[model samples]
Target: MKEHFKVTQRMKRGVRIAGLALAFTVCGAMAWPGGTSRLIRKADQAFELEDYKAALKLYASAVEAEPSSPEANYKLGITYVQLNMPKEARAALQRAIDLDAKVEQKLLLPLAEANHLEHNFSAAKAYYEQEKRSAPTLEKTYQELLRKRIAECQAGEDLMRLPAIYNVSNVGSAINSEYSDYVPVLMPDDKAMLFTTRRPDKGRKSLDANGAEQIRITRMQQGNWQESELFLETQQQMPQHAVVSVAPHGKELYTFFADKGLHVSYKLQSGDWTQPELLKAPFNQGSREPSLFVTDDGKFAFFSSDRTGGYGGLDLYVSYKKEDGSWSEALNLGPEVNTPYDEDAPFVDTATNTLYFSSRGHNTMGGYDIFRSSISNATWSKARNLGYPVNSAADDLYFTLSSDRSTAYISSDRPGGAGEKDIYRILFH
Candidate 1:
């Protein structure tokens, strides 16, 4: 009787344990897959919202859970590309293609871009050609863009083989940071530089929260650039400024403030910038203008805007200062200078009557390339690409000349630098 009781009790205990084990197994199977699906959905949503950092983490988790998932790997690669991490993007994209060859057709162009951005021109060209061959029936516009991309790769390869003799070097950590630093405008005699930086705001704990770009000025002391300081007069409790140009004499600073249009702040007697006031009428026509240059005499202002009646995108516009000290109606720089694509960052060399800016439409190898046009007796000439190493497969914009015109500063993302967009000084021999 005792043995019988012990056997029955042991069997009951075993049954209870098995039931608990079965419950856990069933619950885990449902929760694990469902949780992974939820993560993937959230990641896709974040990516569409342009929350790349958030998407990166969530997609990484999805990839971890399902290493063989081609979709997850491909999406992660796209995120990396958007974040400007081309190496990681290339690897992830290649893995996705390996897992599913079908992804190759869908991913070839972005893969090409990744390679191009990393300065792997040969690989980029090959991928672009492959994409071309695979999609022979693509729209004519897209086909043309692809051909431009291929040409860009060829240009990059050519440039790499025989680079210009110009000695390019980082401006040092004093004027540069791990973050981007570009759009540099050097004053006469190289006395000072007012440029845009994504450096953290000194007073803010979370720099990304109100992360409007801050304008910083670096003074040249004893022939070296000193530590940069923010344009405090432009700073609010929440700073906002995108300085596009500084006058040749550095007495006037022009900024593209949101909605309020171009605001000019002149140097005050106290050695500080006066409160920025929006330029009147034609200049403040409630259009998107990203850059401008005011001649030293302040007689004419060359600006970039996408207002109606433009050829397309952002066309260059020039507004002449009237005798009454007011501005005239904005006049498009016209087809000779503007194209059916964007033309921005206009810098006028008043001494030479030359206009130098960046254009995407006029014979661009791939992306925006710096172009120069001579303004002869009030008529603009045909724009010409600055060419080769001065321009790259990546964007090469914001070209500015020093006082003597012996040296030029251009903003570019060409490889082998600190990172995204560093300013390069071209010393003309």
Candidate 2:
């Protein structure tokens, strides 16, 4: 094992191990058995059964028995990561990688995650990119995008605070409803506004699995927001939740799911919007927690996906928008704007050329805070929290412009709300 980064202090990590879920039986071998593999298997089983103390002891014994087995080392590394011992996990995982460069990239995925949790972005990035490059052909594309995000850290951005006196607000009953409404949009020319919401409609049937459908399109007219109206009913499906993300060229629209699902289409010459259809797999895995945005030229589409080899959780990514308007595989946003918790709900405004979204991994005051950053030539500045009143003790998510840019919209569960979560608007000076 190599000293990738000097261990400063003990690193704290989350306790979740996905692959170590199988039962380990001390199998009776045809001949004398119970070798190092068996011992490791037993230790892993003990971990699965919540017997941490027993698992630790068996792992130690396994290492003593077969001081050089990569499999044993990997298991040990993973256990340490679960227990928040980055120093031990790093040593163990590095040993596993050294022993066998051929292990499924799946193993590197966890190591990359552990490294990021330890705030060793450089090492985490190297591991993530290696995993992406070595992934099975079928998944390499997605993995590549995941790698980009893990390497996106920007130094100055993390430490700077948002400017004072834009006096952020949580638009009251005027815009929000008794449901989850987020992912706002500023209409062309900034006079009209558009946003996504879960406000109930007359007998709308597209209820999500949780029975709360996060839907789209709340408008503001004459200095007031009209109660939200569902967009393109023909494009909706039962038990599905959706949010419109980008509106390009005054007529084109981009949308993503609160859960997983993607719908894209354009308005036809007949004055009716085309029926929305599902984005294909690798791009639309009903399991991807997704977000979408398009560049000024519409040649590239920005999105977020968990995929594989990510630092952890969901990461922001991008894909090319083909001539036919179909989307390509995503590209990770890298270490600059992404972190281990999750980054999604991207709103890329080409006019002001600023990017805004919610992040849980950055220094947040609470659940999820809306962040803003400048976008310049395929690069993004560090994101700054929109702040205090606009960002509260709870989630202050999704930023929508009002009928005019003078006011903005958001959603939260803090203090006042019609239900568990409600929409609120903020006034922008």
Candidate 3:
């Protein structure tokens, strides 16, 4: 998936909307006799258009012009939330509450959301409770969302109490940039890696100009990763392609195309990739199949799809290669692995028969969290959360492990990342 997709998913799962009508009313209530009103109106317009970056700047100016205005501070805080800056959002939202107690009715849910993103679970639950009391007439759907959020906070608290003992670090500037860099796929030997990045085109001034997801490859030389280079072969194939998983032997690569289905490309003897071929029939039956992983022996393929007959949303499914080299009909991984919510980004460790994937359900602190299930006696075990450091209060996906299992890589949007989503290295301890 592209970086924009990740942001959209996060916004859908976490961010709350106050609606443009409420925003207009709030700005109008705080309208000054002069320039502040103009600024507020401009900020509201940007926010309404979903140009949050522009809205962020205008809202900041509004706050600077009126430090004690609850409306300005509240709008600024909401803009921060849209931008995924939880700490800044918490500060601005708290300021709004301090400026006027009445704003608490409008600000509590977003404040709780900010705290939830920061992993301050206890405070988030308190604010959620306060919001529930303040808004007794909230719509039934929204009330259910609040209940789910509170439960997630409890899950976060429980998970944080027994944090994973691992050192998680950014892969650094060699492969990461100010733009989204994620979906890391490592070679079997760990000497090279392939990942997708959403950076500006070579001659473009900024990502907004004409940015697109481009695959990049980096190789380890003398024990340090060399700077990445764009994988032009794959880039030339399509405007939108996501690196899914590399074949265990590194001879074949899997990718997803938006209009097409899952694809595979082979490494030629001369070291160049052949044009990718879309998987046929039963494999591409779904309207949307975002991920796939082939077993080391190449007998079984695991993927995720939202096609009919699924447990719900996107469910993990498996297909076995038939005698004629065609895939069998896809079968859901059963209710234990497929929830009513989405499950995606499957990565299988063939050696252990363990399936690692991200899901919107199952003990998630918030958003998607990585979970693993192993097959034993032909039954998939109940999925287990990978726990704190590897799984945060954000969408974590595309987990890949080194051959020795001492190290791993994952893409996440947790705080302190260089961009919306960055590939992180996890050193098991």
Candidate 4:
């Protein structure tokens, strides 16, 4: 797993870290209390970050500092669960309830999971059901997943299972195929989508039996995707061959030409694509597969390149489009975003003020998983993996989000895909 590798990497660098198998909790931004706040913050951080042992040690000091801190006590209980010490976990959870009865039901969901893992199904089911009823929109999926867990307990399934349930489903046949379909770019209205696929070929590419390239456009009328149909011949000259990336606005598309050139073709206002133009300067120099993302402001372009001078590997560089519309010489994102290891799949989510990408340099739980960091401030922090189900041992990269910021689509080579790679959606709660 990428995470296991990361822990090993950190340890070799003299950072003592515990591997907490890809467990994640949805969190909201909270205010920093500041100062020796460091001790408690570190403890709370270790707990939230899935490092139970360190969290346990730090929480002890946190409790001593503020004996009446209900939050600290509640976190202590959660850390116990992570450490897989049931008796201690139970006692701490009960102590939390005694100190803050409000957590009795709210935090009980995690408590139930701990109990369930410890073979206390009755308690888990009771708590899980109680928590399930607490949220309306979440009830259905929670109930289903709970049923699966409860069944696993009844059947005596192994506690440590392989290829953890991806909890995945296709975006529907509307977006899938018997042929390879990938690199989806959902337009702002979420109504139109332009994706590249290799189907019903012009009969070229490689002689891999499935050789050919094409483009398909689908309109979202009402609420669902209308039937996907191929593009007109005017836009098909280049055959939409090897679409590596697309800008957020769907106004431009980038691809690798069979002639050993990279083209940045413009989509015209009348729904026609103009003659493909050869990209110069910053882009044309990169390797065959180019990464692209047009930032919201429209002038800055973020992409990956292995141009002559880079920190190392395939570094991500940002180019500023001049007033004359020519892109300036690419500037490396520096070693901060780039690494000795290859980093690709550049995506900008300014809604969260973050840049999401994939890297092998950072501690990973598996092969090439998505990691994101805030760009709102001057200095960007280390990137955090989006974590399991959405990411696995298989390569997971190239993501696009709906403009409203509620849903996202990520490309992966994980099994069950229509082909080598398929796009999966993540609807956040």
Best by TM-score: 3
**Weakest ten-residue segment in model 4 by summed lDDT:** 14-23
- Whole-structure CA lDDT of model 1: 0.72
Model 2 alpha-carbon drift over 4 Å, by segment? 1-163, 189-210, 214-216, 257-260, 285-287, 323-326, 376-378, 401-405
1-429 per-residue lDDT for model 4 (tens digits): 454455434323211122122112321122222333567768766665554657789987787787666566566666665544556667767876777676565565556656654556567667757665764554243444444444434332222233334355556678777566777777667887777676756544543334456667788887777778875445465534555555646677666555456677777889776776778776776364356677756777788776667765667878889999888987777666777656787888766778888765554433456778776456666776666566643457777778887678787655556755567777766
CA lDDT, candidate 2, residue 259: 49
Candidate 3 vs candidate 4, lDDT winner = 3
Name the best candidate (by lDDT).
Answer: 3
Q: RMSD (Cα, Å) of candidate 2?
A: 13.7
Q: Which stretches of candidate 1 lie over 4 Å from their true place?
A: 1-42, 57-67, 119-126, 132-141, 154-163, 202-210, 237-239
Compose the digit string of candidate 3's lDDT tens values, residues 52-123. Answer: 777889989988988887778888888787566899998998898888877776767677778888999999
Tens-place lDDT per residue, model 2, 1-429, is 011111111111111232122101111111122344678768867875655556768887887787777667666777665554567777877886787665435466567656654545566677767765665462332443343335332221232244345665445565565555555666666544555555555455553322345445556578666665566666555445555554566566655654447766676778587656666644776447567766646676667777787766777877776677667766777777888767777766556877777776565543466788787786888877776566653455666553345766666655445544666656665
Candidate numbers, best lDDT first, in rank order: 3, 1, 4, 2
For model 1, how does the per-residue alpha-carbon lDDT over 22-45 read when each residue is reduced to its tens digit? 222222233232244677779867
Worst 10 residues of 3 by lDDT: 15-24
TM-score of each: 0.81, 0.56, 0.87, 0.57
Residue 365's lDDT in candidate 4:
39
Error of 3 at 158 (Å): 1.1
